[model samples]
Target: MQSLLEQLFAGITTKSAEETERIARAFAMLVPVDTTLAFHGDLGAGKTTFIRGLARAWDIVEPVTSPTFNLYTLYEGSRQLVHLDAYRLDSGADLDSLMIDDFIRSPWCMAIEWPERIADSLPEETWHLYLGINDQQTHTIRLRL
Candidate 1:
Protein backbone atom coordinates (compact mmCIF):
# COMPACT_ATOMS: atom_id res chain seq x y z
CA MET A 1 0.00 0.00 0.00
CA GLN A 2 1.13 3.54 -0.66
CA SER A 3 2.11 5.47 2.42
CA LEU A 4 0.47 8.80 3.15
CA LEU A 5 3.76 10.60 2.76
CA GLU A 6 4.46 9.00 -0.59
CA GLN A 7 3.70 11.17 -3.61
CA LEU A 8 2.24 10.04 -6.92
CA PHE A 9 3.02 11.61 -10.26
CA ALA A 10 1.21 10.74 -13.46
CA GLY A 11 1.98 12.42 -16.75
CA ILE A 12 -0.28 12.61 -19.75
CA THR A 13 -0.17 14.51 -23.02
CA THR A 14 -3.25 16.25 -24.38
CA LYS A 15 -3.21 17.79 -27.81
CA SER A 16 -6.23 19.96 -27.22
CA ALA A 17 -8.31 21.52 -24.49
CA GLU A 18 -11.02 18.98 -25.15
CA GLU A 19 -8.56 16.18 -24.54
CA THR A 20 -7.47 17.86 -21.35
CA GLU A 21 -11.08 18.02 -20.23
CA ARG A 22 -11.55 14.34 -20.97
CA ILE A 23 -8.50 13.54 -18.89
CA ALA A 24 -9.91 15.59 -16.05
CA ARG A 25 -13.23 13.78 -16.39
CA ALA A 26 -11.47 10.45 -15.91
CA PHE A 27 -9.70 11.73 -12.84
CA ALA A 28 -12.98 13.15 -11.57
CA MET A 29 -14.56 9.71 -11.66
CA LEU A 30 -11.88 8.40 -9.31
CA VAL A 31 -11.55 11.20 -6.81
CA PRO A 32 -13.14 10.74 -3.42
CA VAL A 33 -15.70 13.21 -2.24
CA ASP A 34 -14.28 16.14 -0.25
CA THR A 35 -10.99 15.91 -2.08
CA THR A 36 -9.00 19.09 -2.62
CA LEU A 37 -7.23 19.71 -5.91
CA ALA A 38 -4.56 22.39 -6.31
CA PHE A 39 -3.76 23.59 -9.81
CA HIS A 40 -0.42 25.14 -10.76
CA GLY A 41 0.34 26.64 -14.15
CA ASP A 42 0.60 29.85 -16.10
CA LEU A 43 -2.40 31.65 -17.54
CA GLY A 44 -4.19 29.90 -20.43
CA ALA A 45 -2.80 26.59 -19.29
CA GLY A 46 -6.19 24.85 -19.32
CA LYS A 47 -6.74 24.97 -15.56
CA THR A 48 -10.32 26.15 -15.87
CA THR A 49 -10.89 23.67 -18.67
CA PHE A 50 -10.01 20.82 -16.34
CA ILE A 51 -12.43 22.17 -13.76
CA ARG A 52 -15.05 22.39 -16.48
CA GLY A 53 -14.79 18.63 -16.88
CA LEU A 54 -15.01 18.18 -13.15
CA ALA A 55 -18.15 20.31 -13.01
CA ARG A 56 -19.65 18.36 -15.88
CA ALA A 57 -18.94 15.11 -14.08
CA TRP A 58 -20.81 16.46 -11.10
CA ASP A 59 -23.78 17.14 -13.40
CA ILE A 60 -23.46 20.89 -13.01
CA VAL A 61 -24.68 22.66 -16.14
CA GLU A 62 -23.64 26.18 -15.31
CA PRO A 63 -20.64 27.69 -16.99
CA VAL A 64 -17.40 27.54 -14.99
CA THR A 65 -15.13 30.55 -15.08
CA SER A 66 -12.16 31.64 -13.08
CA PRO A 67 -13.32 33.52 -10.02
CA THR A 68 -10.29 35.76 -10.27
CA PHE A 69 -12.30 38.78 -9.14
CA ASN A 70 -14.78 37.01 -6.91
CA LEU A 71 -12.02 34.83 -5.42
CA TYR A 72 -14.24 31.79 -5.30
CA THR A 73 -17.47 30.34 -6.63
CA LEU A 74 -19.57 27.44 -5.43
CA TYR A 75 -21.69 25.16 -7.59
CA GLU A 76 -24.34 22.95 -6.03
CA GLY A 77 -25.49 19.58 -7.28
CA SER A 78 -25.59 16.10 -5.78
CA ARG A 79 -22.21 17.20 -4.50
CA GLN A 80 -20.97 20.72 -3.90
CA LEU A 81 -18.00 22.00 -5.93
CA VAL A 82 -16.05 24.93 -4.57
CA HIS A 83 -13.73 26.60 -7.06
CA LEU A 84 -11.19 29.05 -5.68
CA ASP A 85 -8.87 31.30 -7.66
CA ALA A 86 -5.98 32.56 -5.61
CA TYR A 87 -4.44 34.53 -8.47
CA ARG A 88 -5.22 37.86 -6.87
CA LEU A 89 -4.53 36.84 -3.29
CA ASP A 90 -1.25 37.85 -1.76
CA SER A 91 -1.40 36.29 1.70
CA GLY A 92 -2.94 33.58 3.79
CA ALA A 93 -5.01 36.27 5.47
CA ASP A 94 -6.70 36.97 2.17
CA LEU A 95 -7.73 33.34 1.94
CA ASP A 96 -8.73 33.34 5.58
CA SER A 97 -11.00 36.32 5.06
CA LEU A 98 -12.95 34.20 2.63
CA MET A 99 -13.57 31.68 5.42
CA ILE A 100 -11.50 29.20 3.45
CA ASP A 101 -11.23 26.81 6.36
CA ASP A 102 -14.98 26.38 6.48
CA PHE A 103 -15.05 25.47 2.82
CA ILE A 104 -12.14 23.05 3.13
CA ARG A 105 -13.65 21.30 6.08
CA SER A 106 -17.01 21.04 4.46
CA PRO A 107 -18.03 18.10 2.24
CA TRP A 108 -17.49 20.12 -0.92
CA CYS A 109 -14.82 19.11 -3.40
CA MET A 110 -12.48 22.09 -3.62
CA ALA A 111 -10.53 22.97 -6.76
CA ILE A 112 -8.03 25.78 -6.32
CA GLU A 113 -6.10 27.57 -9.04
CA TRP A 114 -2.99 29.62 -8.35
CA PRO A 115 -2.66 27.57 -5.18
CA GLU A 116 0.99 28.47 -4.72
CA ARG A 117 -0.21 31.86 -3.48
CA ILE A 118 -1.85 30.17 -0.50
CA ALA A 119 0.35 27.10 -0.27
CA ASP A 120 0.66 27.32 3.49
CA SER A 121 -3.10 27.18 3.89
CA LEU A 122 -3.62 24.05 1.83
CA PRO A 123 -4.17 20.66 3.38
CA GLU A 124 -1.23 18.26 3.31
CA GLU A 125 -3.11 15.62 1.38
CA THR A 126 -4.32 17.96 -1.31
CA TRP A 127 -3.81 16.68 -4.85
CA HIS A 128 -1.79 18.87 -7.20
CA LEU A 129 -2.02 19.17 -10.96
CA TYR A 130 0.42 21.05 -13.16
CA LEU A 131 -0.40 22.11 -16.69
CA GLY A 132 2.27 23.27 -19.12
CA ILE A 133 2.31 24.22 -22.75
CA ASN A 134 4.45 22.18 -25.08
CA ASP A 135 6.05 23.27 -28.35
CA GLN A 136 2.95 22.54 -30.38
CA GLN A 137 0.65 24.42 -28.00
CA THR A 138 -0.44 21.12 -26.54
CA HIS A 139 -0.89 20.70 -22.82
CA THR A 140 1.28 18.40 -20.76
CA ILE A 141 -0.37 17.51 -17.47
CA ARG A 142 1.38 16.26 -14.41
CA LEU A 143 -0.81 15.14 -11.55
CA ARG A 144 0.65 14.59 -8.10
CA LEU A 145 -1.16 13.15 -5.13
Candidate 2:
Protein backbone atom coordinates (compact mmCIF):
# COMPACT_ATOMS: atom_id res chain seq x y z
CA MET A 1 0.00 0.00 0.00
CA GLN A 2 1.06 3.51 -0.66
CA SER A 3 2.00 5.82 2.16
CA LEU A 4 -0.44 8.54 3.18
CA LEU A 5 1.55 11.20 1.41
CA GLU A 6 1.78 9.07 -1.71
CA GLN A 7 -1.95 8.43 -1.67
CA LEU A 8 -2.65 12.13 -1.34
CA PHE A 9 -0.29 13.00 -4.12
CA ALA A 10 -1.54 10.22 -6.39
CA GLY A 11 -3.31 12.77 -8.58
CA ILE A 12 -6.49 14.33 -7.25
CA THR A 13 -9.09 16.21 -9.24
CA THR A 14 -11.72 18.38 -7.62
CA LYS A 15 -14.83 19.51 -9.41
CA SER A 16 -15.66 22.20 -6.89
CA ALA A 17 -14.03 24.53 -4.39
CA GLU A 18 -15.42 22.48 -1.56
CA GLU A 19 -13.73 19.35 -2.80
CA THR A 20 -10.43 21.17 -3.04
CA GLU A 21 -10.81 22.33 0.53
CA ARG A 22 -11.57 18.78 1.59
CA ILE A 23 -8.32 17.59 0.06
CA ALA A 24 -6.43 20.37 1.84
CA ARG A 25 -8.00 19.46 5.15
CA ALA A 26 -6.83 15.91 4.71
CA PHE A 27 -3.36 17.12 3.83
CA ALA A 28 -3.11 19.40 6.85
CA MET A 29 -3.52 16.36 9.08
CA LEU A 30 -0.56 14.60 7.55
CA VAL A 31 2.04 17.35 7.55
CA PRO A 32 4.40 18.14 10.38
CA VAL A 33 3.77 21.05 12.73
CA ASP A 34 6.63 23.07 11.34
CA THR A 35 6.57 22.84 7.60
CA THR A 36 6.20 24.91 4.49
CA LEU A 37 3.83 24.23 1.61
CA ALA A 38 4.56 25.71 -1.78
CA PHE A 39 1.58 26.03 -4.08
CA HIS A 40 2.06 26.22 -7.81
CA GLY A 41 -0.79 27.07 -10.20
CA ASP A 42 -2.15 29.54 -12.68
CA LEU A 43 -4.73 32.20 -12.03
CA GLY A 44 -8.06 30.83 -10.82
CA ALA A 45 -6.52 27.42 -10.25
CA GLY A 46 -7.75 27.15 -6.62
CA LYS A 47 -4.44 27.74 -4.86
CA THR A 48 -6.07 29.98 -2.30
CA THR A 49 -9.03 27.64 -2.05
CA PHE A 50 -6.73 24.77 -1.11
CA ILE A 51 -5.08 26.93 1.54
CA ARG A 52 -8.50 27.78 2.89
CA GLY A 53 -9.00 24.08 3.48
CA LEU A 54 -5.74 23.94 5.39
CA ALA A 55 -6.88 26.82 7.56
CA ARG A 56 -10.09 25.01 8.32
CA ALA A 57 -8.23 21.92 9.43
CA TRP A 58 -6.16 24.03 11.80
CA ASP A 59 -9.34 25.55 13.27
CA ILE A 60 -8.50 29.05 12.17
CA VAL A 61 -11.50 31.34 12.58
CA GLU A 62 -10.34 34.28 10.53
CA PRO A 63 -10.89 34.58 6.82
CA VAL A 64 -8.08 33.32 4.61
CA THR A 65 -7.35 35.46 1.63
CA SER A 66 -4.61 35.90 -0.94
CA PRO A 67 -1.93 38.33 0.17
CA THR A 68 -1.09 39.56 -3.28
CA PHE A 69 -0.87 43.13 -2.14
CA ASN A 70 0.47 42.83 1.39
CA LEU A 71 2.60 39.85 0.41
CA TYR A 72 1.67 37.73 3.39
CA THR A 73 -0.90 37.21 6.13
CA LEU A 74 -0.74 35.41 9.44
CA TYR A 75 -3.52 33.61 11.29
CA GLU A 76 -3.36 32.18 14.79
CA GLY A 77 -5.38 29.25 16.01
CA SER A 78 -4.51 25.80 17.32
CA ARG A 79 -1.53 26.21 15.05
CA GLN A 80 -0.19 29.25 13.23
CA LEU A 81 -0.81 29.64 9.52
CA VAL A 82 1.11 32.05 7.37
CA HIS A 83 -0.12 32.64 3.84
CA LEU A 84 2.32 34.18 1.42
CA ASP A 85 1.78 35.29 -2.16
CA ALA A 86 4.97 35.84 -4.12
CA TYR A 87 3.50 36.68 -7.50
CA ARG A 88 4.80 40.24 -7.41
CA LEU A 89 8.10 39.55 -5.75
CA ASP A 90 11.11 40.32 -7.88
CA SER A 91 13.34 37.65 -6.41
CA GLY A 92 14.16 35.53 -3.39
CA ALA A 93 15.87 38.56 -1.92
CA ASP A 94 12.51 40.31 -1.94
CA LEU A 95 11.19 37.49 0.16
CA ASP A 96 14.01 37.90 2.63
CA SER A 97 13.13 41.56 3.15
CA LEU A 98 9.73 40.60 4.52
CA MET A 99 11.30 39.23 7.69
CA ILE A 100 8.55 36.63 7.82
CA ASP A 101 10.53 34.56 10.26
CA ASP A 102 10.02 37.19 12.91
CA PHE A 103 6.28 36.65 12.87
CA ILE A 104 6.28 32.89 12.85
CA ARG A 105 5.69 30.93 16.05
CA SER A 106 6.25 27.32 16.89
CA PRO A 107 4.01 24.60 15.48
CA TRP A 108 3.36 26.75 12.51
CA CYS A 109 2.85 26.11 8.80
CA MET A 110 3.50 28.51 5.97
CA ALA A 111 1.60 28.17 2.72
CA ILE A 112 3.15 29.97 -0.21
CA GLU A 113 1.34 30.83 -3.43
CA TRP A 114 3.47 31.64 -6.44
CA PRO A 115 6.46 30.17 -4.72
CA GLU A 116 8.45 30.08 -7.92
CA ARG A 117 9.01 33.78 -7.49
CA ILE A 118 11.01 33.04 -4.38
CA ALA A 119 12.25 29.57 -5.16
CA ASP A 120 15.71 30.10 -3.74
CA SER A 121 14.32 31.28 -0.42
CA LEU A 122 12.29 28.16 0.26
CA PRO A 123 13.57 25.55 2.65
CA GLU A 124 14.88 22.31 1.22
CA GLU A 125 12.12 20.26 2.79
CA THR A 126 9.26 22.40 1.58
CA TRP A 127 6.40 20.41 0.07
CA HIS A 128 5.36 21.51 -3.38
CA LEU A 129 1.90 21.05 -4.87
CA TYR A 130 0.88 21.83 -8.39
CA LEU A 131 -2.65 22.87 -9.25
CA GLY A 132 -4.22 23.05 -12.68
CA ILE A 133 -7.57 23.84 -14.20
CA ASN A 134 -9.01 21.54 -16.83
CA ASP A 135 -11.18 22.45 -19.78
CA GLN A 136 -14.19 21.27 -17.82
CA GLN A 137 -13.29 23.75 -15.03
CA THR A 138 -12.22 21.06 -12.61
CA HIS A 139 -9.08 21.63 -10.55
CA THR A 140 -6.24 19.13 -10.35
CA ILE A 141 -3.67 18.97 -7.55
CA ARG A 142 -0.60 16.78 -7.44
CA LEU A 143 2.50 16.65 -5.27
CA ARG A 144 5.95 17.21 -6.70
CA LEU A 145 7.74 14.41 -4.89
Q: 1-145 in candidate 2: lDDT tens per residue?
A: 8764786678788899998998889889998888999999998999999999999999997888888678788998778999998888765455568888887889999899989888887888999999999955588999974
lDDT, model 2, position 37? 92
Write down the lDDT of every candidate, Cα atoms only.
0.81, 0.86
The candidate 1 region of ten consecutive residues with least summed lDDT is 1-10
TM, every model: 0.85, 0.91
Measured on C-alpha atoms, candidate 2 has an lDDT of 0.86
TM-score of 1: 0.85
lDDT for model 1 comes to 0.81
